[model samples]
Target: NCIIAASDYYLDDDGKKAADLYQKACEFGHPDGCKWAGWLYMTGFGVDSDYVRAIKFYDVACKADDLEACVNIGFMFENGAGVDQSYSAARDIYHLACERGALQGCNNLGYFYQEGRGVEKDIRKAKSLYEKSCNDEAVWGCNNLGGLYYKGLGVERDIQKMLHYNKMACDRDLTIGCDALGAIYLHGRGVPIDYQRALEYFQKSCSNNSMLGCSFLATMYASGQGVTKNLKKGLKLLTRACEHGSNLGCNLLKVHLANEKAQ
Candidate 1:
């Protein structure tokens, strides 16, 4: 009912109606509803953008001690949305959510340690937290862990392990992971040159809407490395990739078309 009301209010731009339903839901102990109200206020969705009110609603939900709300508070503190920036406050909220087994909290903590945002730079701790998040099936964590391994950040330079983690993340449907793995395979890093595997991974990434993936898959098709030469199909994919925000795709597609015209 609250969802329906929110949806209806959204369609009609009825700020008062949305606020009323959100208030009722919050009063009923629905932390999610409270969080949504906070978001609505924060983004000015059907209401005037009010960071103060957003913070108030988030504070109310945080007081309920929900892990998600704790994470939101961490974000708020980290970004100083409605309050003064306080790394300590962000760290505490992140810790609270981590204690509650929120994988995202682990990932955020890893980011904090990596960037020394609120703490000293500790690559070891960052890797540990990322590993924990990956174990919890966090795709972002797994993908970033693969990057860490690739960069040898606080870990031994093990290219094979990098590919392994990239493959793991890609198999879990992470487009970035798939694109990274495709690059690794294409360059024969940590493994023998396997354009077929690279093509497959790039295709998977492209299917997931990765511009780089589409561009690279087009390259492979044009080169006839992993598949037969098909300029028309390759050009189509390149155009699509370019439309999807890849300047590399646009440049390559232009070069390809020019070469074809010359031929």
Candidate 2:
């Protein structure tokens, strides 16, 4: 019943009905139903956002051995949403999830170690965890491993390694990876600047809701670095970024305007 209600026939206005049906399915012992109920409550697609309610449903699923539910619970604990902030609890939950074969949980735990949120900072541990996850094809793990190489944390700076990991993530369609790759080429980060390559990557990420990618794309267009200069197109791109909450885009729009007026 819930699946039918939530199929292509589900409309935005039917959030309440969908959530209720999912909750009913949970009552029937369906873990996925419980998970869906929790997610809908957590995100408030068409209902009031209620973290407490979300956690309650998620707990039901988690107790049923849902590793994904455990990871979601950890996120709430990590951020203190509807529950007292407890990094230790979050860490424990992530460990449980990771130990149980949840790759995303391993990535989360690695971040905790890297930032020392609930444990001592251990760059080696973070790197190891990221490596494990990345080797398993976790997109976040690949991107994060690339970050370690870029920042030289617990490892020597290696642009090639950074490029390698980021490319791995990007190949998996990770927007952040695409954005980072674009920046690398645009700024000549340990490599000769290649505006053309940068443009390709920025195009991928920008089209996928990355404001930073859009901002960088605007730079390429405005400066005529790798493509023909077109002030109108540049301004339109900048406007798109600015409307999407990019301070850099807003600032760049001003500069673009001033430059155009001076010409």
Candidate 3:
């Protein structure tokens, strides 16, 4: 009912109708509907922008034990949306949601500990939380753990472990993981130096929409490192990387384009 109406409004771009249905659904005790209504109000998607209303609906959803709602509330607090900026409050709510088994909440708490945002800087605690989230199959958690291992933060420098974690993250279809793996291969950091493997990983990451990966792939094609030199293919990838808003990519593309024109 509410869901159908919401979908209809979404398809029609009818914000007013969506807001009304969501409001009614929220009053009927539908937590998900309340959550959607909160987002709509927060972003002014259907109704006039009202952070206070968003906060109220989020509070209601959180009281209903919605972990996502709790996490959203934490974000609002962290960003000072509709409430006084308070990292402590954000941390507390993030902790609550993490305890409730929200992997994103765990990741956020880990980030706070990692950067000493709302808590004492504790690399070890951050690593533990990242590992916990990773074990729970969180892709970002695996990426963070891999980064920590790579940088030897609160853990021994273990290139193999870093590669392992990045692979885990990549298996979950995370572009970051694919890009990291490509870098490791390109630089011979963890695994044996293999241009072919680097190209493969880079292509995977690029296909996943990573501009960095696209740029790297362009270089690989330009230099004939793994694949045969194809200036045209390289140019296309470089152009795409630039269009994706990578300044380095733009520079690289401009240089190559000038060189091609000179030739």
Candidate 4:
């Protein structure tokens, strides 16, 4: 019997056992196994990074009609992770996936149109695609649409609309949206600066796994902005962020340490 081991290892905590087991299950013909194995290989969470192998597994999974795998393949092509970077190729794959009703694919396809990547720049098209994804409850799509409204990209700048979509995504627990909104509130962008609100949003974002949020929250604590100065807490938060791969956190920690040494 093929081990239904994918979900178990997909958390992928301690080590290579996760990636290895996923691959083993994949070899035994588990379609989900192929996708998970490909994901681990691409990210190198518990195994050596292997873009070629990642693509191969994704291709197999995609051929099995796994739309998510198809989207991953498109992403790999878009970034040239293992193969030659080809925006056209990425666009084609994304188009195929989007046509098949993959919301992520539609969002990425919107990005391509917005950025003029391998396709003619078409802000209206981008807006349409983003709206399609967002209406379908893709949080990233809502975030992107918010950015367009905020920047007036192919639409008149509309702060209310921007906040509406941003809050929509943040309410859904998307860390990026939370962090962005937190920064906006902290800086008074399109609204009065509200350090208390910033603290709440940053705290929410950080607790939900946003490294940047942790870094900003650490800054707030260290600077005593609407909160008591707590160097110990700040340092601990920064260290946590760094361990989780936030370069901003690492850099800030180094800066603070250097300042203390200078003192």
Candidate 5:
């Protein structure tokens, strides 16, 4: 398909060629082509960022029953990107998408319920929605459900359940879940501490781009908790984590730098 080829070209950094192909596909009334074109415009990949034009193409794809396009429209409304900020509108769209079996929409709606953003704050409803999303295989939904279980919000406190859900999410390759498992093992929350297990979980999370995991692993390395002490390796990991926006990593790196200077 021209759209698929366009995507390949885009991934290869031939934005202009991709845009031309996408435009051709869009002219053929391919909904996905229109969506891709909109994305390119929205991100300024192959063209200038034009929120207005992006909205137009997205609207077209959404009208064609593209679920992702509807979600994108909801995001645009929620963030006031090329449109008026209207949480109410976003909520309506998400509700529609959820009704159509979009798990991401269910997860987002659960968040709104939890935070009282567009809907009334209802922890019970949030829990139920999260359960539905998790059942639908949304990893973030499982993570959120684990958090609720851990905090005993709208459900009885159940550490076992929390661990179960978090582990399930981690097994599915969610970095946040891996980070949670690492923390649990590191601190002996519900079981005896196992520094080696904690280190492995943190390593998995860090490999998946979790800055918090990198920070924790760096600390362990620095102190030789589970691995051989290597201050140089620790400092490098800490620096990487900080560069990736971990405030804890940044703070720890600063302390380490100051201590090294003093020595």
Candidate 6:
């Protein structure tokens, strides 16, 4: 299909060609073509960024029963992109998508209920939605559910339940879940402290791109908690964590660098 080819071209950085092909496909009434064209316009990838035009194309695709387009429209409304910001509108749209069986919609709607963003604050409803989303294989839902269990929000405090859900999420390659498990082992929260196990979990989390895990692992290295002390390796990990957007890592690196300069 021309749309698929256009996507390949876009991936190869031929934005102009992709945009042209997408336009052609749109003329043929391809729903995905319209959606991708709107995305390009929205992100200024292959065309000038124009929220109005983007919304127009997205509206076309949404009318064609493209659920992703509807999600995009909901995002645009939530963020006030070429439209008045309205959390209520976003919630209604997300609800529609959820009713249509979109897992992401269910997860997002659960967040709204949890935070009282658009709907009335309802921790019980949030818990139920999270359960549904998790059952539907949304990793974030598992992570959220684990947090709620840990905090005893909408459920009784259950460390075993928290650990089970977090482990489930980690087994699925979620970095946040790995980091959480690492913290639990490192701090002896519900189990005896095991520095070796903590290190292993931290390594997995860091390799999976969790800056917090990198920072934790770096601390272990610096303090010789589990492995031999290696300040150089610790600093390197801290640098990487900082580069990946960990403010704590950045501050620690800055202080270390300053101390080195003083030395």
Could you say which candidate leads in lDDT?
Answer: 2
Off by over 4 Å in 3: 4-28, 36-57, 80-84
Q: Indicate the TM-score of model 2.
A: 0.92
Error of 1 at 217 (Å): 1.6
Question: Which residue segments of model 2 deviate by more than 4 Å?
Answer: 7-17, 135-137
Which clashing pairs does model 2 show? Answer: none
Residue pairs with clashing backbones, model 1: none
| Span of 10 residues, lowest total lDDT, candidate 4 | 1-10
Candidate 3 has a TM-score of 0.81
* TM-score leader: 2
Q: Over the stretch 27-103, how does candidate 3's per-residue lDDT look in tens digits? A: 99999888888888989986799988898999999999988888889989999999998999999999999998988
Candidate 6 deviant stretches above 4 angstroms? 10-27, 36-57, 135-137, 259-263
Query: What is the C-alpha lDDT profile of model 4 across 1-263, one tens digit per residue?
Result: 33445456555473377777767877877777788889889999778899999999999889988889999999999999999999999999999999998888999999999999999999999999999888534788999999999899999998889888988889999889889889988888898988999999899999999999999999899888879999889988999999999999999999877876898
Better of 2 and 3 by lDDT: 2
Q: For candidate 2, which ten residues in a row score worst on lDDT? A: 3-12
Error of 6 at 212 (Å): 3.0
The 0-to-1 C-alpha lDDT of every candidate, in the order given, reads 0.84, 0.90, 0.89, 0.89, 0.87, 0.87
In model 3, what are the clashing residue pairs, if there are any? none
- Rank order by TM-score, top first? 2, 4, 5, 6, 3, 1
Candidate 1, residues 160-209: lDDT per residue as tens digits? 78887878889988899999999888988777989989999999999989
**TM-scores for all predictions:** 0.76, 0.92, 0.81, 0.91, 0.88, 0.82
Specify the poorest-scoring 10-residue window by lDDT in model 6.
132-141
Residue-level error in angstroms, candidate 4, position 185: 0.3
Candidate 4 regions off by >4 Å? 1-3, 12-15, 135-137, 258-263
Number of clashing pairs per prediction, in order: 0, 0, 0, 0, 0, 0
